[model samples]
Every structure is written in C-alpha cells, then in structure tokens.
Target chain A: MDLQTLTYIVVGFTFALYIGIAFWARAGTTGEFYAAGRGVHPVANGMATAADWMSAASFISMAGLIAFNGYGASVFLMGWTGGYVLLALLLAPYLRKFGKFTVPEFIGDRYYSRTARIVAVICLILASVTYVIGQMKGIGVAFSRFLETDYDTGLFIGMGIVFIYAVMGGMKGITYTQIAQYCVLIFAYTVPAVFVSLNITGNPIPQMGIGSTMADGSGTFMLDKLDQVVTDLGFKEYTTQVMGSKLNMFVYTLSLMIGTAGLPHVIIRFFTVPKVKDARSSAGWALVFIAILYTTAPAVGSMARLNLMNTIQTGEVGTVEGNIEIANVPQWMLNWEKTGLLQWEDKNGDGRIQYYNDKNAEFVAKAEAWGWKGNEMTKVDRDIMVLANPEIAKLPNWVIALVVAGGLAAALSTAAGLLLAIASSISHDLLKGVFMPDISEKNELMAGRIAMAGAIGLAGYFGLHPPDFAAGTVAIAFGLAASSIFPVLMMGIFYKKMNRAGAIWGMISGIGVTMLYVFQHKGIMFVPGTSFLGDMGPNWFLGISPNAFGAVGALVNFAVATVVSKVTAPPPDHIQHLVEDIRVPKGAGAASDH
Target chain B: MNKTAEQYWKANIRLVSILLVIWFACSFLFGIILVEPLNTIKIGGVGLGFWFAQNGSIYTFLVLIYVYTKRMNALDVEFDVHED
Candidate 1:
C-alpha cells in the first residue's frame, strides 16, 4: 500500500522475471553464448537492441540534462539516434554477412593479422569498461533510492543480478531478458510522461503536448511560456540557448553518431539475427523502439522544467509573493532532500525558496530590495529530475514504483550487454584466439563466465568510487569508440586495399591522440588534479571541448591509415576475397562459426 | 564480382550516398550551420532549426534507414542475391 513496499514489490517481480528468463535461456554452446544460436527474430532482436542501446544515461539522466541544457542537449538526441542509420546502412548487414562472433574477430580476419585483432580488442575493452562504470552507478542510484540502501550495497546487489543471468545465459539469456527489459522500461517511461503531458496541456501525446497551448487557457504555446518564464527569472531563453560553440556541437554530435555506430555491444546485437536481411531491417525496428523514448525525452524535459519552476516561483518574478514559502514546500522536495540531491540554504534568513539566476548582476539590486539572499536551491542535481518527476506531479504510488523498476531495467540491460562484449573479447578474442587456440568449447564457455564475473566486479568497484568525470564520461567512451574503432571497421569493409599494418597503426594513432587530448584536459585516466593543462575553454584547441575532439582524432586516423596503406603492400588475395564476400549477401554462413 | 552483383553494390553505394546527404543536411546543416537562418521561420510553436535538431532530424533518420533497407532488399532480389 505504501510507496516503499510498492517499489520493492515491483522491483522484486522484475528481477524474478529476469532470473527466470536467464535460467530458461541458459546457453549450451559457444554459438548460443555469443550469438543466441542465430535464431532471434528481427523484431525480437530489435527490442533487445533498443534495450542494449538505451543505457542508464538515456533512461535516468538524459531528460534531466535536457531540462537544464535546453536546446544545447540536442547533440545527444541527434548524435545517438543518427548512429543507428549508419549502423543499418553501412555496418550491420555487412558484419552479419561476415558471420563473426566478436567485432575484433572481423578485424582479425578481414585484415589477416592477429595484431589488428588484439588492437581492436583493446579498444573495445577500454570503451566498454568505461561505459559500464556509468551503468553500474546508474543501477546503484536506482537501488539506493528505491530499496533505501547505501550506494555500495546497491552496487553489490546490481552486480549479483548481472552475474546470475549474464554468466549463465550469455547473449542468449541477455537477448530475451533485454526484450522484457525493453517492455518494462518503455512502459515505465511513457506512463508518467503521458500523465505529466495531459496535466500540463490537454494533448495526450507528450511530443505534441510540448508544442501545444497550456491547459489553463493561457493562449501561449508551451515553449513560448517556458521561454518567457525562465528569461523572466534571468535565465537564458529555453528555446534559444545553443550548446557551447557551434563547431563543438557539430563535432560532438558527429563523434557520438559514429561512436554509437561503432560500439561493440550494439554492433554484436545484429549478429544474433538469422539472416543479413534481418540485420538490416532489425536496425530500423531498433531505431523505432529507441525513438519512443527519445521523442518523449524532450517533452518530459521541457515540461518538467516548466513544472519545476512553477513549483518554486509560484507567481511573477521579482515580486515578494513570487517565491514559495520554505514551510509550504512540496513533499517531493523534502523526499529528494533526504537523498542530499536537492538542498537549499536561507542566506538572507528569508523563509522563501528563490530558484533564479543569482549570477545576473542586473538582478542583484532587485534581489537586495526584496531582502532575497540569493538562489536558495543550490543543489538541484540534474539526475533527480526524472526520478522525482512523478512524485513532484503527485502521481500514484504504483506509477512511481514502475519508474524505479524501469530505471533498473535500463541500467542492467546495458550493463549486461557491455559486460558480454568485455567478457567475450577476453575469452574468444584474447584467450582462445591468441593464448589457447585449441581450447575446447566447454572450456571456452567456462572462461567466458569467469571473465564476465570478473568484469562485473571491476565495474562495481568503479561504481562505488566513481571518478569526477563519471557524469559525462559516457561521452568520452563514445569519443574513444568513434576515434579508434569506427574508422577501422569502416575501412575494413569499404577499402579493399587497406592492409594489416595500416589498420593497426590507425587504431593506435586514433586512440592515442584522443586519449592525449582528453588526458591533457581531464587528466590521465581522469584522475583529478593530475591534468597538466587545466580544463578551460581558452586552453582548448579551436574552442572545441575535449568531447568534440573525437572527430579530429578520427580524421587523423583515416589520413594516417590511407597514407600508410599506400606505402605498404595491399592485403593478401584471400583477404581481398573475404572483403568481397562480406559485401555480397549470397552464401552467408550461419552465425555458428563452424 | 559478377556483373549483377557489381551493379547491385554500385546501386547500394549510390543510395547510401544520397541518404547520407539528406542525413547531413537535416542535422548538420539545418540543425547547426544554418540554424540562425532557419530559426527565422517558426514551425508549430518551436523554431524550425530547434525542431530539426531535437525532433525533425530523428524522424528523417528513421525514414532514411527504413527506405534504405527496403530499396536494398529490392535491389538484392533484382540481382538474384536475396537470401532464401
């Protein structure tokens, strides 16, 4: 009946469903472990892929980011979704035709060099491991909020859930569980959005609702009202704010697009489908599923911002009656305040909460005249926007519980996908491909489980003591993948003359330059206080943020590889034939390597 | 490569090029480069450029991928390369 009990029950039921799916789908062979026996229908794989692609960042944090960043956050929406187009058009079907288990394996065979495979494995591990840390933290946050546990305990529990299903089911288990996860997460996400939309505007569709007039017969468009409200409080107009420099937004979007297309976890999902045609169409379906959440996000974001402002600034700005009395603050604020995510201080001993731009010197005189101290809501963390939205809107307890379950599903599905990519690279690419070429299938499967368990442990540890960059490190992961992996994969497929030497050198240079730029700004491995060149705009090259430097790194990679390949001998005839073979859909082998 | 397979590959390349150009125009051009000019024109309570960046480009991307898959499938059939 209560919120806590309801959350535990809903979350418990979802976890039980996942464990059941895992037990039922336990993988029996390497083919099943890595590619789900290549029997997954296109639509099912699409659902799985959507679950795999939308991580905790998308479910929990993206709308929150949009709430504050306004128009600037469009880079994330466009960059992430556009990459699926690249995946479907340029990468997916061809890779499916290649019939490989791991992305590095495709590189290893296509380049006819083990070194290239090893390099690829390294890139995949780096990007995936970094990405998984965010997912682990996301899971920890969801558990901490819902189950009322400490972050460390929540992380440990999350790691255990992944270990049970991922170690036992592998890709086979993960796929079906992800399909379930997609349903849970999408349902949870859209329900509250629909409620919030209807309450704000009469329109039921959040997308159209955001563009329609307010329900109170205000006659002003929602965006028009939102822009007027925020700017009235000295903040930037909601619709007019651009993210950073134009070049940076462009490069950042480009990096995320190619990076999304390049992620090993996402690319491998297409390999589970039965045919090349399935891979192509499955990508379209995946985008359709992802778009459901993506479209709802902006609506949730802008509307949540509108709702949040209306809660605090209950009337016109600069007036004494505008701010809400601290004693009369909504119960949701107190609930989030207990988590230390939302905080306020009465500097001028004013009993009212002022949510406005304190940095606006022009408003300082007005604030002084009104006896206002400053912006009292100092710690309204962006992560709380989505999690606190339902409570803020006075939604029923069951809907709030469903949001908790959905957040966990989004976080866990993505973590499992990344863990699988990491573990398989260790067992199949590193161990069997390199160390023990004659490893039995049974022994390889064992190795895969051990590697997966080990990865979860490492990810959990990082989640507990997340680095300063954890909030934005996902962009870094995308940057690394875009710079290091995507270019080489694209080259291997499109350029027949690209040789082993070129591919290896290209990966090294791409990752190397990207890392150097990032480390110089963010610090090596993102260790705080270790950055030699402080992270400041004036210090950046061409006013490009470290996040946008991936495009430059990718360009350098393409250039270096092309120049190197011209000097070196072309790939052997057999490798050329392999490339030609992948290009055509005929005679595609079953996903099973045998 | 056989003549039919070769032509199919070329057709695929041409199609990708055209689709990708549309992709570039929607997101990079309208959303970023020419956003200021596009913002002069409002669409449905939002700036056209902002709509492109936030909503319109994604719709176009979905349509592009779906169209590519359909056309490529048809081309595969024409070249007698469709999988059984």
Candidate 2:
C-alpha cells in the first residue's frame, strides 16, 4: 500500500482501539470518574503514567533538539528523568496515603485553608492549560502532516477523539486508553530506531549501537566519526558542546526536574494505584518505561545527525566536489521540503547543496575560496528529524505510518491527561468542594464530564489559534509548576508546621517572581515587541535564562515559607496529626470524597 | 508520634537523603560540573560524562526507586505500619 493509505489505516486502527477501550472502561461513580476507582494495578498505572508524561515534545521534538544542540541537550534527558526520583522518594507515597482525588484537595486539607487550595488550583490550571495548548498544537501538526489535511480539520478530529474518551470514561477511560497508547508509541519509536541502528553500526540495539564502531569497516567509533565530520564542517564537536555557562545548565536541569515532579497530571496518576507502596513502585515502573525511550533518543539523535551530514557531505569537506548535487538530492529531502520544514538554496549558484556552519567566521574565508556562498540548507526545522527519520533511512512505509500513529498517540494521551487534571480540579475542588458542598454524587460526576468537555473546547480553540508564545509555553508551564506547586506540596508533607498564611504567600511570591522574570525576558504574556529588556545573555539574572529561574524561585519559596511559618502560628493540632497519618501506609482506604 | 513510627520516618528520611545524594552526584556532578574532567575518560565510543548525562543517570534513578521501594516496604512491615 501507499504511504498515505497505510498511515490512515494504522492511525484509524489505533483510534478505534482507544474508543473501544473508552467504552469498556466507562466510569460509573465519582470515585471512578476522578481516581479510576482506586483499583489500577501498579504496573498498569505505571504504563499509563509513562504515556501521560511523555508528551509530543518527548516523542517528536526531543531527539531533533538533541541532534542540533549536541551535548548541551543532556539537560533535557537528565532533567526530565531525575524528577521521578523526587516523585518516588518524597511525594508519591505520602500523597497516595492521603487518598485524595486532586492535588488541590490535599493542599486545602493539609493547610486547613480553602485559600491555600485556591492558590494551588490557580497554579495547577495555569501550568496545565499552558502545557495542554502545546499538546493541542502538536496534535494539529501531526494530523496535518500525516493525514494530508489542514491544521484546523486535524485539530477538530483530535478534539473529537479526546472528547469521546475523556468525557465518557473520565480517568478510568484515560488510564486504559493511555496503556494502549504507550504500547503503540513505544513500538513505533523503537522499530525504526532498531533498524537504523543495525544499518549504522551492525548492532540492533540503538543504545549500544551509538557506542559501537561504524559498520563500514572505517575502524572509527560512531561518536568519534560524528564529532570529526561535524567539526570539519566548522560546527562545534558533537560530544562536548555546552549549552551556556555550567551554572545555567545546572539550574536549567534542576528546574525541569522539579517541574516534572510538580506537574499535576503526573502526580494525579499515583492516586489511582491501590496502595502507598504501589505508588512508590509505580513511579519506578513509570521511569523504567520512560527511560526506554529516553535512552534510545540520544542514539537516534546522534545517528540521525551523522546520516544527515554523510548524505550532504558525500565526500571530504572544503573540496569543490564534496557537496551533493541539487539534481541528486534524496527523495526524503524533497518530501520534507514540501512540508516547508526542510529548504535549501543553491547559494553562489553552485547547483550543489552545502550544509555547514556558515556563521563560523574562521571558516568564512575558506568557504569563499571553496566557491561557497553560504550554507544552502536554510530552514531545517528541528521538529522534522524524528518524523522524517524512517524516510531518511529508507525504512519501510509501514514504519513511517507507525511513527505517525505514535506521534498522535503521544500528543493525544498527554492532552487527555492534562484535560482530566483540569476537569477534576474544577469539579472536585471548585464546584463540589467549595461552591456546592451538598452536590449529589451523580450531579458531581456530570459536572466533571461537562467541565471536561468545556476544557476540550477551550484547548481546541487554543490549538486552532495558538498564541505567539506557543513555542515558549512549555518552559513557562514547567517554570510555574516548579516555582509554585512542587515546593508547597513538599512542605505540606515534610514539614508538619507549615501554616496556611505561609503556604499562600510562598506560592504567590514563588510564581510571582517566576512570571515577572519570564515576562521581562519573553515579553509580557509573550506579546511581540514587549520584552523591554532584550532576551540576551547580559540582561539575564546571573546569566540564567527565564526557563532556568524556576529553581531559584523554588528556593525563594522554601525560604519565605520557612521564615513566615516560624513567626506565625503553627498548623492546628489535628492538621499536624493528619500529616502524621499520611506519613504511614497503614489503613489507607479507597480515595474518598470527604 | 509513637517511638517505632518516629524511627520508621527517620529511617525513611535517611534513606531518601542518601539516595538523593547519589542522584545529585550522577546527574549534576558527573553529568554537568565534572563533565569536562570526566570526558577525558572514554567508555567504548562514549565519553563517561556524556554517558552519565544521557544514560547512566537514568539507569541509576530506576535502580534507586526500586531499592527505596523494597527497603521502605520492609520498614513498613517492621514498624507495623504496612497496609493490609
């Protein structure tokens, strides 16, 4: 079958599978709606969490970002995974023991203040809404590219899929559907990787292949060969390029770590497990599943970069005949070029595509002597690397179709998870917890579904008309979660004396400073031309980008909360006892409405 | 809090602290701060630092969580606080 038809069939099959699972797992009660009846097995919850956590960014963009950034992108690999340690060790068990439906409920009950819960709700909404917009956009992009449809039609379809599963089955449906999604995405991701690895290094495992010698009898290690090839083209060596100062990378990694732990969507998954011990082990399983993709990603990135360079520089660098002739450009390049993500121009009218680091001033004079005008590949969007990997490697059309399905699965799974988080907070925390304390169980479940539908509508609208800061929304979401939610939750569990006033002020100040810093650098709400202080290194505080400032905000939160609690009254006696109760694992019953 | 419960909490804290230290050393120390010096050492085709940043730390994190889970479960039983 043709590529387009195969993609349609594979994607259609996966959608049918998800809708089927949704029907099989329709939630019947408030407990099922919010916490999947608190009966999910540890391994199953772990798989669901993995699917929920690995968004389109992880599945689609991470490898490409790593390819271009080289060693500097290790921040993402380490930062994203390291947070699970914190989640497993410090947060998950305690939260599971508390047996709450939503994160804000824990905050409100622990601090004995509705205001604290509201602050948490605001933080959760802000982070999750911004995060969901990115997923919605990813869905649109994947649909448009694979289905050969316009972005709007793709987004509407994605929204319809999410609505069918999320509104009907709630967390119960999302959990099972995400398990199926994890299987699809992981299979799609690794199959191409395994093939590419064998082609590149004669090893089937991508992780080991990246560390092995080249398969062409070149007697050179893959990394050594990649470093040599790119450095010869005036790019930095692939193995040791730092992102910025060591301090910046340090803070940036820390920010992402805490942010991952802080994300409400990920945290809520633990609540579905049966026991506190399961919660801890469940996080381990989640990390194991996530690490499978995370480890393979670097290999895919390095090998893809090597393949791309080898294709362009068919011969030695700095030679007249080194570049590929325009007429002989690969079919893959032509295919991607039609998507407008990969473009090339025959600079200097040489009729050859020269892909190199043209901005390297030391290489400029040499390039002139070599009769090169500039780097001919003008717009190689990093997002294209994974989507185009199979085509670039000449893998089967089925593999390519599988990748399209995988990308949609990643995007849809995460979007559903975020929408669920938003819906639960509004229904469980806002409507039932605060506005309608006397709401019937059936009425509350209905409210949760309606809220979920509304969230999907809002997310679809945002996807159709993404904001200017859509590109930067991930960083903002992470920063907000890191600065506000993670610190407060940690204090609530670990520090028995943290009072309402302290928690409230700490959240406001933490998120406040983070917002101020990000807005100053990225523009107020990312309005174009509004970043009064240009987003340059010299203007940054301590040479830290706004994205990396979350850790600092978290530190400030810890400090302010500690000091404020010292001077104010301690938490009430029963609240301190509640903390003690959560610390132990015994008598943890099913997640209750009370 | 009861004495055994206090001890259990203390033990949990101590285990977490030690694991967190290892976590920091693997990712932040070897991966970032000491990356330059560690890059001088090679494992196969990979720099030790690069391997830690991208691969080793993730493996270690997985191991740490499992270890914690086993130890804490044991502690829960010993302290008579384990769920039925």
Candidate 3:
C-alpha cells in the first residue's frame, strides 16, 4: 500500500478508537470526569499514566536528543524515573487520601485560605499552558508530516480529535483510551528498536543491545567505537562530554524530576485509583510501565546514532569509496526528505551528500583530499530518527503504520490528559469551588466540556504558531511545572504547620523567581529592548540554568513556609486532623469537601 | 486504635528511611558522583556505572518501590491501622 492508504488506516483507526472509548465510557458526574469515578485498577491506571507522561516529546524527541548527547542524556531517564519514587513515597498516598478534586483544592482546604488556592491556580495554568502548547505543536508536526497536510490543517484536526474525546468522555474516557494508547505507542516504539538492536548486535532486547559489542568487528565497545568514528571526523565523541558541560546536565535532571511530579495531567492520574494503597501501587506501576519505554529510549538513541553515521559514511553499507547519489538515497531518507526533516545540497559538483562534521576543521582536510567541496548535507532534524526509524531500518509497512499509530497515541493521550486537567481546574476548582459553591453537578459537567473546547482551541493556536525553542517549546513546560505546582503540593501534603499566607507567598516566590530566570534565558518571554544574560559563567547565579532553577525555588518554598509557620499561627486543628487522617488511611471520606 | 496509629506511623517512617537511602545511593550517589569509581567495573560489556546510570537504577527503583508498598501494606495490617 502507498503512504496515503497506510496513514489513513493507521491514524484514522486510532482516532476512531479514542472516540469509541469516549462513547463507551462517557463521564456521568464530576467524580467520574475528574477521577475516573475512582475505580481504575492499579495496573490499568499505571498504563494510562505512562501514556499520559510520555508525550510527543518523549515519543518523538527524547531518543533523538540522547542519540546526539550520548551518556549525558541518561539524566532524562534517571531523573524522570526517580520522580515516581518521590511521588509514590512522599506525595501520592496523602493526596489520594485527601481525595480532593484538584491540586488547588487541596491547597485551599489544607491551608484554609482561598488566596492560596487562587495562587495555585495561577501557577497551575501557567505550567499547564506552557506544557499544552508543546503538545499542540507536537500534534501539528506529527500530523503534517504523515498526512501530507499543512501545519494549520493538522493543528485543527488534532484539536478536533482531542476536544471530542476529552470533552465528551473526560478522565474516565481518557483512562481506557490511554491504556489502548500505551499499547499502540509502546509497540510502535519497540518494534523498530528491536529490529535496529538485532541488526547492530545479535541482541534483541534493547538493554542487551546497549552492552553488546558493536558489530564493527573492530573490537571496540559500541560507545567507544562511536566515539572514535565521530571524533576521527572532528565531531565530539558519542560517549564523552561536549562544550565541557556537566553542571547543566546535573541541574537539568533535578528540574525534570520536580517537573514530572508537578505536571497536573500526571498528578491527576494518581487520583483515579480506588484507594490510598492503590495510589502508591499505581505510582509504582506507572514507573514500571514508564521504565519499559525510558530504558529502551537510550538503546534506540545509541543504535540509531550508529546507524545514521554508518549510512552517511559508507553510502550503501559496503561501499566506502563513492558518495551517496542524492537521487538514489534510500527510500526512508527520501520519505523523511519529503517532510523537510532530511535534506541535501550538493555544495561542490560532488553530486553526492557529505554528512560529516562541518564544524570539524580536521574533517575539512580529509574531505578535500576525498574530492569533496563543502559539506553538502547541511541539516538533519532530530524528529526524523523516531518518526522515520522503522523506514530507516527498512522494516515492514505494518511497522511503519504502527509508528504513526504510536505517535498519535502519544500526542492524543497527553492532549486528553492536559485538556482534562484544564477543564477540571476551571469547572471543579474555580467555577464550583470558588465562585458558585452550590453549583449542580450537571452544570459543572457542562462547564467542563465547554472549558475543554476552549482550552483545545487555545492549544491549537499555540501549535500553529510554535515559539522557537530547543527540544521544541514543550521543554519549557518542565521548567514552569517544576517551579510552580510541585512545591505547593508537597508543602500542602508534608508540612501540616503551613498556613495559607505562607503557602501563597512561597508559591509566588517559586513561580516568580523561576519564570523570571526562564524569561531571562529564553527571550521567547523577553520584553522588547531588554538585554538577556550573556554568559553562562557569570549570568546564572550559583551556576543553575533556568531549566534547573525549580529545585532552588522548591527549597525557597520550604524555607519560607517553615519560617512563616513558626512565627505565625498553626493551621486549624481540623486541618491537622486531616493530615493525620491521610496517614492512617482510615476515616478518609470518599471525597473531602472541607 | 491510637496505639495502632502510632505504630503504623513509626513503621511508615522507618520504611521511608530505608527506601529513601537506597534511592539516593543508586541515583544521586552511585549513578552520578561515584560513577567514575564504578565505571572501572563492567557488566555485559557495559560499564557497571554506565549501566546503573542508564538502566540498572531504574530497574532497582521499581523493585524498591514495589517492596516498599508491599511491606507497608503488611505493616498496616500488623499495626491494625488498615481500613475497616
């Protein structure tokens, strides 16, 4: 079958499956909408959470980033996984026991102040909006490339798909749909990885592929072999540091951890399990499911890097003497070439693409000796690795079909989760909890749908006009979430002495400082005519990048809250009892209103 | 029940300490700072430290969490702090 027919069957069927799940499991009440009626089994919720957590960024970009960065990118795997430990052990149980509808609801009730709740809402919206913009952009990019539609058409179509499932079915619908998504996405992710792993090493499991000696017959370890190849051509070693950077890597890991914990979509998934124990069990399950994908990503990255370099070097695998004629480049290259992710420009009359390091002065001397004029292959987008992996490995059409289905699974799962989070924050936390305390459940449900539609439209707008940023704009979502919501939720749960005033001020401090730090570094949020920081050495205070500033913001929250709580009054005795109740796992109301 | 609550809390705290220490050791300590020392050892042609840095630690994290939850559930029953 042609690309058009395969794409229609894959993408169309997945979208249909989501709508089918939504109809099968339409949320009847606010509880069902917000927390999946608190009935999801741990394993099911775990699968759903994994789908929710691994967004377009994880599906499309993470492995590609790691492929280029080598060992340093291990931070993403470790930090992201480590976050579940903190969530399960420290946060999830209590939050589930409290059984509030939203994170802000917990803050408002626990701190005994509406002001704190509103501050939390502000933080939640900021983090979530920044995050959702990235997802929308991911959907647009994925759809445009595969469907051969323009970016705007893709964004609108993606918006329609998310709005249908999220508004109609809510969290309850998204949960079952996400479980389906997890299967499709993981299967899509692993098939190509399995193929590439087996091709490069005799190993089928990606874990083994990472360790197995390179197929190079050169007796060097894979990373060591890769290091030699790229370095010989004036590129940085595949396993060693480039730009002499570890400080940024270390801090970036911390930020990713807190950001994972802080993400509203992820946090809301934990609220779906039946009880506090299930919350703990489900978090572990989420991590376990997530690890399957996270662990495989590095293997995919390393193997794909090797494959890419080898392709560029030898042209057709065996022939190292001649160049890869542009017209005759393999089908996968040509396929991705159509997407504008892979391109070639013959700089000299060399009629072939030279993909070696243009930045390497050493490669220039060697290349000139080989009758090459300038570097002809100017750019290769990272998104191509994951998007074009099956094709690049020359896998079956079904496998390529699976990749499209998986990318859609990732994009749609996250989009639904974010949409639900936004809708609930508006309908449950703001409209009902704050403004109309006596609003009927039916009205709130209607409001949830309306709000979700509005949110999807806004997210679609962001997708169409994506802000230029590395790893795309979704990267900043991590920074914003880390600095904002994580601190507030943890403080509310762990610190019983915390008061409303302190919680509000501390969140402001965390969100304010971190946002300023990010705005200073990324001129995306820069004011016109304002000069940003020039040097990493001098500008970032105490050597923390804007990406990692969230951890410091968290520390400030703890310190500020502690000082304020000590000097001021303690929380109401009932609120103290609420904390104790969360721990004992008894007398936790089916849902806490106060 | 008051006695049970105190015992359950104590057990929870104890379990958290053990798990937290292991978590820190595998990730913050072994995976990062002491990675150099452990890199001298290789497992399956992968450096021991690098394996831990990438995959080993994640596997360990899952095991530790499952064990923690299982033990805590048992402790909850032992202390009679479980739900009715």
C-alpha DockQ of every model: 0.80, 0.91, 0.65
Better of 1 and 2 by TM-score: 1
Better of 2 and 3 by TM-score: 2
TM-score of chain B of each: 0.96, 0.97, 0.91
DockQ of the two-chain complex in candidate 2: 0.91
C-alpha lDDT (0 to 100) for residue A396 of candidate 3: 82
Candidate 3 ranges with C-alpha deviation above 4 Å:
A150-152, A215-220, A242-244, A315-322, A361-375, A465-472, A524-531, A534-539, A592-594, B1-4
On DockQ, the leading prediction is: 2
Provide the lowest-lDDT 10-residue window in model 2 chain A: A466-475
Error of 2 at B2 (Å): 1.6
* Candidate 2: pairs in clash: none
Cα lDDT of model 3 by residue, A1-594, tens digit: 977688789878877887888899988877888988888999999999999988888887778877877777777778788889878888888888888778888778888888887787878887777777778767776776787666677678778877767778888988998998999899999888999888777679998888887665756667676777667656776665421246666666677778788888888877888787888899999998899998999889888887777776764322345467766778777666665656788887656677777667877887777766666777687765787777777778887888887987898898888888888888888888899988898999998889888878776776666553224466567777777778777777666677777777778887777777777765545333343764255687767666566777767766776777788877888888777777776655576454
What overall lDDT goes with each candidate model? Answer: 0.88, 0.88, 0.77
Question: Which of candidates 1 and 2 is the stronger one according to DockQ?
Answer: 2
Q: How well does each candidate superpose onto the true structure, as a TM-score?
A: 0.97, 0.96, 0.94
